[model samples]
Target: MAERVYPKLIGARLRGQTSYRASFALQCVSSGLGQLVELGVILILFGRVTSLGGFSVTEVVLMYAIAGVGFGLADMVAGQLDELPAHIRTGTFDVVLMRPLGTLAQVMASDVHLRKIGRIVASLVALVWALAHNDIAWSPATALLVVLAPLSGAVIFSSIWVVANAVCFWLVEGQELANAVTYGSGSFTSYPATVYGPWLRRFFAFVVPGSFVAYYPGLALLGRPDPLGGPALLGWVSPLVAVATAAVAGLVWRFAVRHYRGTGS
Candidate 1:
């Protein structure tokens, strides 16, 4: 059912945005430029430093593009949950509950923000450049991983975004922190996860598990060993991590819905 419904919802959104073609195009351009500028920062830094942690510039770019694609995908979909506060405040969410559709699906499908396609485009550009610049030994596993990494990461990011929006049920004011966690996870995962201190790395890896999506897989993919200690096997754990986080998010959402009382707006 989701497979059938999601595309139609997104298509409707695309048509709506298409009505204002110029505005949509500009947003896409700006998003691409923003990603490019970030890539420039990494390039400039690499000019002075040969590598970060144990990974070289090209390998890092691969990690960046992977995480970028993941988050861009999530932001294009679940990032719509950022508006939950407005929905609750204005009593719009009451209608959401009254509808026959699943509340989570409705919330995610509410805004098919096409502007994020720019970030995805930029990620693809960076990904192609990285592949060209770095000579990664390609094999069946690596080929499969390339598809799995971003896909698993996108699901993880969307789950985190859902959890963040679920908090709006009670803590109506602290939305920025949730937004930070969503966008910041992208930044945190884009680089070598081992570069950070043990505590910070543990927080993202065990607590949030963002590192599993790209950084660990990146190490395995690039054939570089992890500097901070852990089983290298964790690299392939993206699917498991995605399942865990998403399950937790689902439980939290269920709890939130039960506790909800109409805002009376």
Candidate 2:
């Protein structure tokens, strides 16, 4: 028999979630409301301070938007990483592996939370509002670069989740560590990266690659020169960090599958 993974599984999950219209609608509204509170915080912060680490209120809002959209997309589509331990403990993981489809694909597509669409829409509105306040000089090149920022943010965050979940093949405690990277990084990135000290900022940028997703691409889009004196090439390369992280994540996922030890075996 011939079988492929990912698409079928994702379709299955999407259909299952959409089946409950009332629950899904409530989820969407709740997610939107939650993001509204985040926007309110930004407004309060800006009210108190003129700028954050040289990031204008608009740039700070852009960071929030990029991080928000990325997080909402990841949670909606790939948030199943949260349930790995329970699956393993219950021996349900065996059923997933029994399928001809890839184990990671099946696990990832196990759930799709559609309410994130509301959050994503909210992020876009925030981004647009930021642009209106601090209009950047428009060029075709910069325009496309700005657009890619959020996409890169999404990929980076998803990759972090992948690595975090991969550790579950060894440790049940992997879940907590994973949250620090996924949730912590998302919360941290929502602010201006420059607000952190030099070492911390560099770690997020070059080490973890969070900087590429929000800060660097933001600079390109907002027409702000790089504070680190990064060359012009860095602007174009911001989006590529997401692709690179995703590629590395694929390798990590393969390793986790290879290292799999059957539950209670």
How does each model score on lDDT? 0.87, 0.79
Tens digits of per-residue lDDT for model 2 on 61-172?
9878877888788877678788987787677888887877777767777777777888888888888887777778889886786677787788888888888888877886
Please give the lDDT score at residue 147 for candidate 1: 86
| Off by more than 4 A, model 1 | 1-7
The candidate that wins on TM-score is 1
Each prediction's TM-score versus the true structure: 0.94, 0.92
Question: Relative to the unseen true structure, what is the C-alpha lDDT of residue 2 in candidate 1, on a scale of 0 to 100?
Answer: 64
lDDT score of model 2?
Answer: 0.79
Please provide, for model 1 over 1-265, each residue's C-alpha lDDT reduced to its tens digit, 9 standing for 90 to 100: 7678878987898899878889999999998999888889999989999988777899999999989889889888888899998888888999989977789998988878889899999998898788778877889998888889898999999998988788889877658878888888888998888688889888888888889878988877887667777777987889888988999999999999989997766
Q: Which candidate number maximizes lDDT?
A: 1
Q: What local lDDT does model 1 show for residue 217? A: 83
